[model samples]
Target: MSRPHILAVAKLVPLLLDQLHTAYVVHDRVHEASPEEFAKVASNIRAIVGGGESKVTRALMNQLLALELISIMGVGYAGVDVAAAVERDVPVTHTPGVLNDEVADLAIGLMLSIARRIPQADQYVRAGRWGKEGAMPLTRKVSGARLGIVGLGRIGQAIAKRAEAFGMSIAYTARSAKPDLTHTYYPTATALAEQVDFLIVITPGGAETRHLINAEVLAALGSKGYLINVARGSVVDEAALVEALKDGVIAGAALDVFEKEPHPSEALWTMDNVVLTPHIASATWQTRQAMADLAAGNLHAHFAGEKLLSPVPECN
Candidate 1:
């Protein structure tokens, strides 16, 4: 029997790519194929695979007459048109939980990096300004500070756990209160920002959450506070953040994700009060391998007539 045809819409890691090739006849990036070429194979494709940032639109799904599953190699599936997939009776699975620790670790890391000016200090020493200009200015302390998390999901909970170790007071804002947790809950992001010294965003992205953290929230954070974003960039208004940073509406910011990824606003490039990372919250080798394995496992399970390992909440 011929192997099932798999369409890769995004740039997948080599490990996952190799595994897919071994089990199926993989068409790497069929979205990039010529119109005629894509038409020839579209109906035969049985599955779709992509990374976190991949775009799987309704049009693409409409072309796949036999698409049974979509396996995403990352936790965030904001780019996938999940409603369209569900309407088509296709289930979407993503690798979650596996990378919770990694993302949480990066959140804490970014908080420290920004609050203490670690990156700036390193630059100062590298430029020999530290020796020439005398002692560097004192930075904020993380321990015993108030922390407000924008989301209280698994990753957010992990971050809160770490903050507790630093003796930080933790609070959060979610769609609604989580009754089991003892931490303080706020009804809105602005309210949470006003009460915390460091505000970390770890919420999901989409129209409902787009620009959830806006000028009001940043202003509430105040000039003495800081912003740390380890969530989707759309969750925060990038333009507002830029303006706030420029006006010192907030003390500083550390961001891993941006509205325009791999190409954040040029203005952010020169800001000394900001620390930026290339959306690598789950980029570690071990975590990536685990993600790849889970993604491939979902595909394998679907093809084998078994239950999926981690279907997205929407699909469930």
Candidate 2:
């Protein structure tokens, strides 16, 4: 029996590559395949494996006449064309729940890193300026501070749980109030920002959430407040965030994800007040391995004619 052909839209970890090789003929970088070579094998390709950053467009899917499943290695599937997949009755699966803790942990870490100026303080010590500059300027505290969370879903609740251990008070804003919860709910992001010392965004990225935290919300947060985003970068207005930082509309920001990604605005790089990460919120070895396993499992399930392990909400 011939192995099923799989198109790899994004690079996979070595372990997953080994696992996939055993049962499938993996085509690495189908996007860059030679036209003749791609044409020869395109119709035989039955599955596509990609990450959150990979583009799974309708046009691309249209090329793979035999495509049955699109599997994503991460929680966010904003880049995948789910509607297009649904139109063809092709299911899209992603690894969720597995990375919730890692993301929540990073959100809290970013809050403390920005609030206490941990990165700056480390730089101060490394430059031997601690003695010369004297005690690295007093920074704010985190314990017992008010924390307002935007999008109080699983990860948001995880963050709130972690923040509670630090004695931080919690309030949140979502599309609607979640029943059975005790935290205060604000209908608007601006209203929530106005009341908290730290405003953390963990909302999904899409049309409805794009720029949910706009200039008005930043202004409401005020200069004493800090912003930490572990969610989609589009959730916050990047240009407005830059302006707010320049004008001291908000004290500072620590971001794990950015609007442009790998190349966030050059303006943010020069600002010592901001802490930026290269979208590694769920990049831990264990978490990444688990996500890879789940993604691979979805592909295996699809080929085995069994139920998918983690189908996206669109398919479910």
Error of 1 at 283 (Å): 0.5
TM-score on alpha carbons, each prediction? 0.98, 0.97
Error of 1 at 15 (Å): 2.0
- In order, candidate lDDTs are 0.95, 0.92
lDDT of 2 by residue, 1-316 (tens): 8999999988788757888999999998856867778888899999899888788999989999999999999888888989999999999999999999999999999999998889888888999997886877788999999999999988999999999999998999999998889999999999999999999999988778999999999999999999999998889999999999999999999999888878899999989889988998998999989998999999899899999999999999
Question: Superposing every Cα of model 2 onto the true structure, what RMSD results?
Answer: 1.2
Error of 1 at 302 (Å): 0.5
- The residue-by-residue lDDT of candidate 1 on 1-316, one tens digit each, is 7899999998888979989989899988856967788888999999999998889999999999999999999888989999999999999999999999999999999999998999999999999998899988899999999999999999999999999999999999999999999999999999999999999999988889999999999999999999999999999999999999999999999999999888899999999999999999999999999999999999999999999999999999
Count of backbone collisions within predicted model 1: 0
Question: What would the TM-score be for candidate 1 when compared with the true structure?
Answer: 0.98
Least well predicted 10-residue stretch by lDDT in candidate 1: 29-38
Alpha-carbon shift of residue 268 in model 2 (angstroms): 1.3
Model 1: residue 67 alpha-carbon error in angstroms: 1.0
Residue 224 in model 1: lDDT: 94
